[model samples]
Target chain A: MIIVAVLSIIFYLLSLYRGFLIYPGFLLQVAYMLIRGIQLERLPLVGPHDTLFFLSSSLVAFAIPFMFSINDERQFVGSVSVIASVFAIFSLLSRPHNIPLPPVLRTYWFELHVGLSFFSYALFGIAAVLGFLYIRNKDQETEILQYKAVLIGYCMFSLSMIFGGIWAYLAWGTYWLWTPKELWTTILWIFYSLYLHARLRKEWMGMPSVVLGIIGFAVTLFTYLGVSLLMKSSHTF
Target chain B: MLCPAYISVKINMFKKLLAFFFSLRTAIWLLLALLFMLLFGSLIMPARPEFSSLNSMPLFDWLGENKAGITWWLYGSILLLSLLTANTLLCSIESLIRKQQSKKWLLIISPQIIHIGFLFMLLAHLLSSTGSFRGNTVAYEGSALALPNNLAVAIKDITVELSPSGYVSDWAVNIEYLSDGKGIKEDYLKPNSPSFYKGLGIYLKDIRPYPVKTVLLEVSREPGAVWALIGGLLFMLGTVTLMILKIKKESSS
Candidate 1:
């Protein structure tokens, strides 16, 4: 796993100049996840290590589309590669252990819930990068792309929350739990919703909305990692 | 006949209030307020022991019984959400009425659909908060437990599979629904898989196999489950449609 992650990061860095090497890098990450999943006999999304690996893979997956669509491909892809590499490094730092899936996490709904949530996080990650580029370069196109990324991410996150609610209801008989993790999830969702609404106004279009995009991703990361690590909740890994 | 000065002023104030509730700005501000309150509650919940009782019962029941400084954030959030709900309804109504003649029907109607879905979700939570029932019971094999509505559940069997490492590989509980001292239905419950009878659901929370063959089962009745599912579906549908439409429009332009 360490060798695969290091190779993937190297390919991602090489893709900054070559741009085509991203495909191989993304493939390597996916292969690693597939191998882990086959070995574990379940989706490899139970702990921080696997989840971070999944997030890094998703970041590459989402960044692939922009490589062809955007004009500032090098910068955008480079930013994504850097962020994804950091997460990959983080995953490497955390020791991996093979454990059977707990009874509570054996449901298809839970798998879908976790999968979609990480994918949405990846989208938000891309949006934050775009927002940063826009702030640096004052590019109007980057701003527009940021909005589009956020719109898509918001939809996916909403679906993820819905699946989570359904899973919770099935396992615990309540759709929503009053836990710190759940509360932060709602806060993150509403923060993005506020961003969406702020984008509708003319004055908030350029910098304000872009800043929200960046801040929203920070909130997303905190919700995904900080809540589970710092606070006591059912989401503790 | 001319209206009195005070009456005219009062009518103008009422109109201002209506306009405020129907504006997008109000929606944004209310969402921001709710977000802040939720953030505060998230912090306070971990630091305060009083807030731990939040999940012990329905939300309204908790609110009615516990009045403490720690819960002020929740109270404030509920108020903001109520106001936000009103704003959502009025804004959707205003939009539909104003855009009634627009040629882009999907574009015009998509946001309203989302609003309706949000309202339905809020209603689902409200219903569950006020009327939901949750109870936990431990039952051994062949033991019968009584439920609401004169329904009884009999534990028929329990299965626990242990792996080589002595970890629980799989587990399930077989149960029969009895009414009037007769079995009506038989089903099995596993983790994340609950059995539903009428409107009530039975979930196998845990199992103890060695000392005694007993299982911890949780019975709950949520009146809002279906509504929440419907609302979630509609919300997804509207957002997807609106996103597609926007993307197409942007690309074309």
Candidate 2:
């Protein structure tokens, strides 16, 4: 796993010089990692370690189609590759362990809930990177790309929350809880809803939207890790 | 009759108020206000740990008492969210009314549908606040506990599985929901498999297998659950439809 992640980072760096190697390099790395995960009998999303690994893979997956379809996506791909590599390293650092799946989590809803949530988080991460770049470079194309990422992220996050609510009802007898993790996630959703509302106005479209995008990503990151680290909650990392 | 000048001034003020509620600026500012309040609320909860315990307390009672800063911040967030909800509803209605003139039905209706879903979810939570029931109870094997509406719940058996190392591995509580002194349904209440009877959900929160063969169960009845589920579906459908349309438009460009 570390080798694949390290090779991905190397290829991303090499792509900066060659500009053509990123496509095949990222694809091969993700394929190998995915094949390994398949051999493990479950999706790579049981704990923090596997979740981050899956996150990195999903980020690359989001970038792949855009890399081929859009002519202006090379720089975006480079930026995302750097960010995805960071997630890979973080996954390795978090002490990767094969979490024994409890009988409770052995359900389709559990996988769906975790997978969709992590996938949307990766999309929002990409959007945040483009948002920062848009602010610095003031590029219209990057702004459009950022908007698309946020739009897709918004959709996936909504679905994840729905699945999560249903999962809670099935597991804990209530659809909503006042737990710190649940509250923070709800706040994160509200932040993105605010971002989407801001997108409606012509005046707020350029820099303000990008800034909000960055802010939204910050909230997402906090909901993902800060809740577990800093606060007490029922969620097990 | 009324004074013409005074009537005109009143009309102007009302128009400005309506415009303010429907304007994107109002929506943006209201959202920002709600976010600020929520951030403050979340921060203060950790500072005053008792805030979590007081979740089931009524808002009016909390306000009537002299409390910590977190209480005000949390209530203030609820107020701001209410204002935002009203703003969203008004804006969606106004936009739909305007779009009617252009005859762009799909484009006009998609967002309004999402806004309606948002309102439905809020309504669900609001209605739930009135009659929602949550409680923790301990029931031993072969013992029955009577609940609201004369529904009785009894623990039939407790099964505990131990690992090779003699540690507890997994546990389950077999429970039966009864009505009129007869068992209607029997189900296993495991960690993830909670049983729902009528409108109530019964979960096995904890098990005591060492000294006493008893289980701690948390049961809750949420009348608004169905509404929230429907609202979630509508919200997702609206957003997905709009996203697909936007993607198609962008790709064509």
Candidate 3:
């Protein structure tokens, strides 16, 4: 597993010397995984190949954010975000179209549900670093970068949940199921709520907000991905 | 913040009620309740299996069979939802009435947008819970699958292959469907890919070919997608803009 992760990261980074890493590389990873699977003959749930695919795909896309200079990181992340978004559209494209349909991903609610949530997770990732920095360094040098990222993250996380709940409504017919995922998300949302409240109610600012911001984002990651691995939801793992 | 010395029982009752419905106390309680529930799901209990097929009983079904257990879960979640709804609604309303004069447009509008977005989401869930939105998948070359809630999917054709090693090499599917004879269409879906018609979508599940080849698909729909998107975009923009404006002002100063 460690080797696969390393390989995936390497391929993902190498693929970036030019553009478009996950898509073409994804096909190769899939093929390699299938061959490995045949040797194992039967491994359940954690298809190592598919896991590699997902890891590489996510990391490569996430790397774009850090790849840019301070001035250019936003554009770098933005451009890659646009390109990676194409895969989502392509998920709807089944040329001459002979791909077996997988469950857990078939519904519009599920798509938008998972899609918006992941975007929000990515958004949180961007926001989280700033919040972490704010909580760490109390100096003025990091203040501008700190605040900007938190703002972006807060906006994205809120939107993600609202949209995700709406999509859940479409799929599961419930706005909030209080599933482990839902529960943790609400906890995360509440942490943000407290930060907002502290800002207005007590004139709390600076590191306090950033501290909460950092905590909230860690919870947000759990809400999106960690929950699948560590918790349980009606939604697939 | 301060503690009042003493109060009459009646006033205290009112205060507690007010606190329960509007205070952070209620929100925390709701959040805690969900945490316990989630822990139950992950550690002690399991979420009910969503019944997509008749051959197996899902975990949800088994737990729900306890009758009282299902009721507890539902009521617990509702309690949380109600508290959340009240918090968001009242906060927004109070702001609109009390702070409208000094209100920052972004703050005022963003909260309203988010609150109403939550309400709409609740409303859509209400509509769907009653079983209004229903759908199924149909493979191009397979028979119709009878599903619950008066939904069915006809598989048009599902292609499957295995490499010499035996793991599945590829899976492809063509599907068709109709509901109330009005909403009907056909689509081709694959792994990580989905196709939609009449508000319903078909998603590829898994593919296997050994003794015989098979493809699986899951179908779904949601009536509140547009509202969610709208709320999400507005909220994101509002927060980011406000933060940026503050940062810029501070820098210039």
Candidate 4:
């Protein structure tokens, strides 16, 4: 897996120089990892490493479509490839040595819940990158792309929260427990909501909306990493 | 018989207030205020175990007593969220009234549906805050638990499955809902699946193998759960519809 990540990084960099589509390397790597997880007889959400690996794969998977849809998506593709490679490296470094899936986690709801949530995180992360690049370059196209990405991510995030509530009710007998992770998730949702609302106003259309997108991703990072590492909650995985 | 000047003054003031409440700027500011309050609550309160209970408890109950300095922020957040809710509702209504004559009514109306859904969820939380009941009970084989409204829950059996490594593979507990000492329904409660009885949700929280083969059951009834569920579905429906319309418009343009 580590070798495959390195190969993906190499091909992604080559794409920048060669101006050719070389994302198949990343796709192959993700496919291998997923097949490995399936062979292990569990979803790819068992631990921190598995979760990060899934995020890396999902980010690359979602970002690939943009490359085909837009003419100037090479830079975006390369950036996502770099970010995905980093996630892959982190997953390799932090992976545990053969831990079995716990009984509590052996449910379809758990898989659906985490899978949807993390994939949405991937989309938001891409939007955040676009936001940052737009700030630096002052490009109208990047700004529009950022908005679209955030909008789709917001919808996915909403679904993830709904699925999470259902999973919570089934497992813990309540729709919400106000855990730190859950609270932060709500905050993240609200942050983007503010961005979308601000988009309706002419004064906030240019720089301020992009700033919100970048800050929203920072919140997303904290929710995914900080909450899991720092807090004592049922979602600590 | 009313003075024209007085009527005009009152009408102008009402319009100003309506515009203020329905303004996007107001919604953004209120949302930011609510966000800041929630950030404060989640970041500061969880560090201290004593005040951590504030997270799970209602804001009104928390404000009834002092818990360091977090209580004020919590109260402020609750007030801000209430204001935000009112803003959302007013904006939705205002948009509905204005867009009644537009051709793209569905495109405009879907977002209002989403706003109404959010308010419904707020209502659900409000109702649950005052009416919900949650408690834990230990159930053994043949043990009975008396409940409200002349209802009861009786434990029928317990089953535990262990892997070759002696780790617990799975566990289930059979429960029978009794009304007037008559069995009305039976269910097997597992980890991710809870049993429902007369609006009460029964969850098998834990299992004890060596200690009398007992099960820890958590029973709760959220009177507002149905409302919340409907709100969630509506929210999803409205969001998807809006997105589809937005995409179509973008493509056409």
Candidate 5:
């Protein structure tokens, strides 16, 4: 698995120049996740290593569609490949421990919650990269793509939160908790909500909205990792 | 009729208030305020011991008892949320009234539906905060625990499957609900799978088989569960519809 991940990273880096090399990298990343899932007998999203890999894989997956659709495919594809490679490298650096899935994580709802959350994270990550590209090149098409990514990511994130709420209600008899992780998740959601509303105004369309998209992804990363690492929360894993 | 100037002034004030509530700018600022408040609360929660009581009881109850110095962010968040709710309601109302003549019904109504879903979710939290109940109790086989409303739960059996490495692989607790000392219903509770009886839910929190087979169960009554589910579904439906419509419009254009 490690060797496959290293090869995937190598291809992702090569794609920064060749652009088409991302396909092999993306396939290898998918294969890595598939193998991990089969070995774990569940969704391989329990720990940091698995989730980072999933995020990297999802970033490549989402970037593929945009690569074909957008005019500046090379620049966009190159940026995404670098970002996904960084995530993959981080996943490789993290120790992979195969522990038995706990009973609380045995439900389909939990799996959906984690899966959709990471997928949304990947979308938001791509949106941030696109936002950066737009700032650099000042392209209207890049801005539109960023908006579309944020819109789709927002819907998926909302669905993930709903599933999470249901799972919490079933397992803990409450739809919400006052823990730091939940609080940060809400913060991330509201930040994106602000970005969406700001996009409607004529004044916030160009630079301000793009900055919000970039900052919003930072919040997403904090909610996913910083909360678990810095605070006492149920998402410690 | 008394004074035209007074009436004009009053009407102007009302219009200002309406505009304040229905403006998108207000929504953006309110959401930003809420995000900051929540971020502050998240920071303070881990730093202060007083904030730890937040999960021990209902939010309203905790708010009344906890120190304001430590919980000011929560109070601020609640105020911001209240303002945001009003903003959502007024904005939806304004949109519907203004777009009444528009032919594109889905585009006109999708955002309003999302607002309604948000209102429902807030209501669910309100109901749960005031009416919900949660408590934990430990019991073993043949043990009967008394509950509210002349009800009781009797543990019938307990099973724990452990791996060779002494880790719990699976566990279940068989229980029966009793009314007037007569068994009314039988069910089993496992992790992530709670048994609902009437308005109460029983969850198997933990199990131990050291000296005697014992299980820790959490009994809770969430008055907002159904409302939350409804709200969640409505939110998802509205968002998906709006997203699809936007995508279609963009592609066609």
Candidate 6:
């Protein structure tokens, strides 16, 4: 865990320095132009504001898990969670200027449903790594990475469903669409539901649960990005 | 033994096929395939059902016919989901069912609840997509409308506007409600809030005070929606509770 964290930090820092060096041919230069009074809405990949948010977020996400391996840690995980949260907040704010949520969509229900949804996925993103780690190892009795992985993944699954139901009730007058995105999300929730159920029953172990965990995260990624990219969502900005 | 060698060969062949068709590897491939195809669809494919001859195509053309290439896409997606659901259910059925005898029936009941919630969600969305609702603002400080049903809403006044600092400072909506052609209840609504009437719920999504309040009241209704909400909440609570108890027990043991 510590090694992975350290490697991630090194890689993230490298990406940052690379960003600084390659300023002209990319979004940073445009952001620099924006800083000098250009419009923010007209930028491309890796916008200036987005770059900062990713750098800081990746650092926090990379660095926090190291402490868990260092000693019995207290709230280092919680702090990292806060960082992931702030990353989502910045991402929400960093929308392309062409499209923005309507004023009506900016209400408290929107924040609770959509905001919580993003943060939950960010957590699951971290958990996916832990799940993969568990799969690689031959052992499963320990309360190491598998527990943490399943815990966060299941947490995200639960919270997303809750918020989604509420959002659907308010926005479209219904909860589940079984659309590609919704279907994949439900599949993920089911996959993890099986994970938690097996864990509690002490029947499934090692390769099986780990594999499920990893795959659940894969579906989670699709639910997050693949569907949005492929289909026009009912909840589009 | 009688034909021991032949039996062994048959067993080996079955194992190979079983491993091939229904394993974690296939699930991963299925997932990646969904991502790959969806990416392809979004980037290159026409928005929806591109026609060879626009004038020739009928007004209500079949979704599959216009989109010649996407039927397989849709079919393939359903196939993928079926495989995944089968895979997980197969893996976890014994464990899940084994605990049905446990005193904490929550384990058994929770999944059932979640499944019900999922079904309701699917039904609700399908209903919303197919069914239609009409929404138009009744202008003026006091304008009332009589719909086909006895349901009527009188817009006493609506004012919404943002303050100088971009905060919604002055926003208010006054509405008169009626049921069965009789004036019943009236209330003032603001942003971030809503009110309900006879299964017809109205939300003050936003307001812009152009002297008279321009109220954006989002309205939606489906019979027994509250039941779906209740089911969802129960499922979440039950899953969370069951997970915690199981984890604590395992760690303690």
The candidate maximizing lDDT is 5
As a whole number from 0 to 100, the lDDT of residue B5 in candidate 2 is: 100
C-alpha TM-scores of all predictions: 0.97, 0.90, 0.56, 0.92, 0.98, 0.59
Winning candidate number (DockQ) = 5
Clashing pairs in 6: B158-B213, B159-B213, B160-B208, B160-B209, B161-B209
What TM-score quantifies how close candidate 6 is to the native fold? 0.59
Residues A57-152, model 3: lDDT tens digits: 443344444454244343444444343333322322322112333333345544444444555555445545545444555644344454444455
Kindly list the interface RMSD, in angstroms, of each predicted candidate in the order they appear. 1.1, 2.2, 6.7, 1.7, 1.0, 7.1
Global lDDT of each candidate: 0.88, 0.78, 0.51, 0.79, 0.89, 0.51
State the lDDT of candidate 4 residue by residue for A14-126, as single tens digits: 66655454566666667657666777777667677777877887887777766665445666766776787787778778864355665667887777788888888998988
**Which candidate number would show the highest TM-score if scored against the true structure?**
5
> How much lDDT does candidate 3 score?
0.51
Q: Model 6, A55-80: lDDT tens per residue? A: 33432444345435523223334334
Better of 3 and 5 by TM-score: 5
Backbone clashes in each candidate structure, one number apiece?
0, 0, 28, 0, 0, 5
- CAPRI tier for the interface of model 6: incorrect
| Decreasing lDDT order of the candidates | 5, 1, 4, 2, 3, 6
lDDT of 4 by residue, B1-253 (tens): 9999999999999999888888989999988888888888777767766665644455446557665465666668778878888789888888889889999989989998888878888888777766777788888999999888998989999998877777778988888889999999888888788898778898887887775888888888877688888888888889888878876776566
Which residue segments of model 4 deviate by more than 4 Å? A13-16, A19-22, A69-71, B1-14, B51-68
TM-score of chain B of each: 0.95, 0.87, 0.61, 0.88, 0.95, 0.58
Worst 10 residues of 2 chain A by lDDT: A65-74
Fnat of candidates, each listed? 0.85, 0.55, 0.17, 0.59, 0.88, 0.15
* Poorest stretch of ten by lDDT in candidate 4 chain B: B54-63
**Cα error, candidate 1, residue B173 (Å):** 1.4
